[model samples]
Target: MNYRLKLIVSFALLISLAFGIGGTLLISSSYYSLLGEEESAIINEYETLQNNLMMINHFSSASSAQNMQELIDQMVERNMAHWQALSIKSSGETILESGDQSLILNYVNSTKEGTYSYVHINEGSSRRLLLYSKMSTKNDVLDLRASFDLSTSYKQWKSQLRMFWAIYVMVVILGVAVAILFANILTKRLQSLTNATKEIAGGNLSMRTGLRTDDEFEQLSRDFDIMADQLQENIQQLKEDVQRKENFMGAVAHELKTPLTSIIGYADLMRQGGLDEGDRLTAANYIYSEGQRLEKLSHKILDLLLMEKDTFTLRKISMRSFMEQILTTTYPLARKKNVNLVVSSDDVYIFIEPDLAKSLLYNLIDNAIKATPEGGNVKVIARGIKGGCEFDISDTGCGMENKELAKITEAFYRVDKSRSRAQGGAGLGLTLCKRIVDLHNGNMVFTSKPGSGSRVVVQLFGNMSQEVDYEK
Candidate 1:
């Protein structure tokens, strides 16, 4: 059943149960007490009659006994009008009978002594109450009995019960009417609530249950409305985020296409085969430089995506040897600018992805060498750190300001645009390098100041903790 009906029915049942229990106790107690009082009177009369008959027997006269019985019967009739019926018996035979007197015989047999009392129910009718007794005297014993008609008492109580039931019937009729009235009102409210809920479920956030009753149900309705409002706000925010990501993707496409278009155009001019060696060489140089820029852009975008996905593996490589090889490869670039590229190692060894480690070292060293002026020095050092390997590259170069250094690893971000371009770099090398290190669960840090120097440190974690060997 619905909640409101359940509540009303529950309350009504509680009241009905209370009434039923109380009525049963009251009716039962009254019935038993009435039966007890009748029995008491019968016992008293039988005892008195027994005493008088015994005196009459001492006189040895039937006339006197009969006279005494008459007088006692008359006295009983006068004093106890509440007694419904009476009877007299002698030697197991009825001398006088009244009001279902066979009921008296049953009690006479049961009360064989001078006097006794008990409740006797009529056969086939548990509802009827009969209180009876027997008395005795000398050899010619008289059986005196008083019979109280339980049907009389039961009828009286039932008449009162009939009146009570009439009132009870009227009460039930009124209760039903009130129940329907309340049930209707509650059902209507619930139907409205259900309709509003369906609309809200169909994505209409504006729909609301406008119940204003100051109760718990009203509070729940208000809470549902608030939750719908918050849901709407969150959906709108997600839509805006999707739009922003789309715009950023378009911007990135345009940026990457610029270098590719330049490189392709230069390559086509060289392929036309209408130029001297000098012109061909120049065209080739343009194509090569633009190709490098395009490659850098492509690598940066790929790195950013990969970092988000975080798919990388650590493979065995010697950090000391890796740094030395990187220095040897970059020696020509430093020499061309009349700068010294110093390579040093504390002989650190660790297992990691060789390519990623190489890229990280190359990015930092290239940045340092490019920033260094003529006759400046770029120092590269690799050593063991706590359970990891560290590479520190420091250059006495034209370092970045605090603001520029903070964004140094951002794609396409540079302190001096033309200087970075002239140095054959696309400003993505550091960003890609940082992302690759991050994928290996490593960190990259930079220390720099404008016009003084710059230092970049990279830490690659050791394999000790990642020894969940697949081969095993």
Candidate 2:
């Protein structure tokens, strides 16, 4: 069943159980209390009659047994007027009897002495109480029984019970009404949350349960909203990742297919064996050049794929020594381009994977060198920072626009595509550098404008260690 019905029914059952048990006990206690009161009154009357009989017997002026018997009979007759519905029996023979004596026989042979008992009698439409007492006299045993009509009290008790039942029914109705109201309120709130969940399931991630009750349900609603928010964020991130991968794959395919197509065309022409020696040599050269381009593209793609799965082992390395090593390797390219190369650093050590760090530096330095004009300057500076180390590569190159700088790290995204391609650039260097810096728990920041020189700063967050891995 739905929550509304379940809540209503459950509340009703609980109230019913509480009232059912309580009402039964209340009525039963009232009944016994009334019966006890009647019984007490009757017992008092029996005791009073016994006291009067004793007094009459003690003061009698009779010396003979026959005379005493005559005196007792007179006393009983005089007192009979005071006792309504009363009966007196001596030794199984009735001395005096009046009104509704039917229940007297039941107590006649009882062995109990000097005690009273109460019995209920049913006569037509009325109920009666019989109080029987046994008393001992000098000459005989007397059984005194008092009959009382309980019809009046019984009618009062029944009437009270009827009123109580009416009240109980009213209370139950009120309880049921309250239960339904509470259940509907609770269920409606829960239903709103459920509907929000359904909407989210139907791909409307913006759906939210804006419940604002100051209770636990409200907290639960808040928690549900947070969960939905996280779910939406995660799903969005997943979509972006998928889209990025698709774009990357499409770019790689295009890059690879272009070179392969050129190579294939040139090779086919050479294979046809129709061109002269010089033309055939030219075709061979074209095929070789395209093959080299394809090879370089494939290597870069492999590097990116491996970097995705690559693990790092960070160790201590001297900042100055590391820069010197990179500068030695990069000096040839700078000299070939007739660009000035400079390196400056403070003597410091940092934790880094040597190979990945070298690759990161190489990509940045190489890109800086390639971007600079023939007579421009490229500077590499390394230093100890608060947490770890920082490297700044500044180049007097043709700087990039803000928009181009934002997308420069994206694979195959070049500021000057034609110039980059002419300079043998596949546009994967910055992308690889960015990935490495991320893996090292660091960040890269670029500062440049269309005309001004560009400065790329690399920040690595790591602990400084005096010890260095000489082998690495």
Candidate 3:
């Protein structure tokens, strides 16, 4: 059904087929070998029986012919139960006296010179062993044969075959199970990787194949996760850069238009040819003021453009004084909105890029001030954590929902884009902060509840000299 299952089943079927073929070959060879051994044993036994029978004839010839039949019978009986003596009239082919009269008559009737010395004694019995000879001093001769049935060897071979097949089946079953088990384990790992890849292809970068074993599948899983993580980060960065460029363009246009509009209005008034000297001077001053606004907008645009690039470094700075300086700079903006901006920190010295770090804190505090209603509160807090520092910016503002917070870090994603722009931001402020933190090997966490408030926490690991390899 699946790739993994296909591989597993294919392997299992191969083993089963191989076992069956090998077992059939072994059984066939062994059966024939057993049969050959049985035939050889019977042949050897018959040859020995013929030799013993010839010896009996010698004994009978040496004895007296007075009670010839009696003497032969007595001697044959003493020799063995299966052998018996007999007297025969060879010319008429009749038995005169014999311990086995019917058998002697049958042999005499069937005998002819130059016939087989050993052969089957009966028409219906192929297993019979026969030895016939002409009489030494009489026309009568002696005949002897030993016959056997194959019932015993047949039973033994059947028993052996049954045992062999039983063991064969058991061994084959175990072999098949082992093959299937290994195949399934390997295939199952591959299946997980395939499914995870599909999810990743569909833009679900969080999907991962969590393999427990140390093998090719595990290596593949690690590679896939690393690839997905890199891809996710690259896509995020590209989106942010593109959005920042767009927003920078828009803000510059708007900012330039405002100043240019005022400048053009003042110039037009002066060019009307009827203005007083004082009024003309007033228009020049207004144009100058508008032109300065253009300068301010240009500076902000430059800052936004730089934020789209990668530059993460640290400069030795006091964490407490840094927070104080940011507050001093942004306090006027907070006062304009009637919002209380509070700053607190655990005293610590941090090595950080002051410009970028200041930009980060400024954006957070500024956003909080704008979002907070009149008389509302915005707080900036910093602390020294284990091996790192923690910065938190919180506001009693119209917060965000879970769905909005989830994608808040995504570029160009703003709950209030127009309001954010009017507040003198490119909306790349938080996104830039996140990138700078990432470059510093740090993390950003956003916690928010609609209508309640929002808190943004930034955790930046200390630039400590240690054996910890970030790549690992």
Q: Which structure among the candidates has the greatest lDDT?
A: 2
Q: lDDT order of candidates, best first?
A: 2, 1, 3
Residue 336 in candidate 3 has what lDDT?
92
- The window of 10 residues in a row where model 3 has the poorest summed lDDT is 463-472
lDDT scores of the candidates, listed in order? 0.70, 0.80, 0.67
- Give a tens-digit lDDT track for model 2, residues 316-374: 88888888899889999999999999999888777777788888999899999988999
- lDDT of residue 352 for candidate 1: 65
TM-score of each: 0.62, 0.89, 0.47
Candidate 3 lDDT: 0.67
Q: Which pairs, if any, clash in model 2?
A: none
lDDT of 1 at 356: 66
| Maximum-TM-score candidate | 2
lDDT of 2 at 68: 37
State the weakest 10-residue window (summed lDDT) of model 2. 63-72
Q: Please list the residue runs of candidate 3 whose C-alpha ends up more than 4 Å from where it truly belongs after superposition.
A: 1-20, 60-248, 268-274, 318-348, 357-472
TM-score of 2: 0.89
Q: Mind giving the per-residue lDDT tens digits that candidate 3 earns over 165-197?
A: 787678667866776787778777877888988
| Stronger candidate by TM-score (1 vs 3) | 1
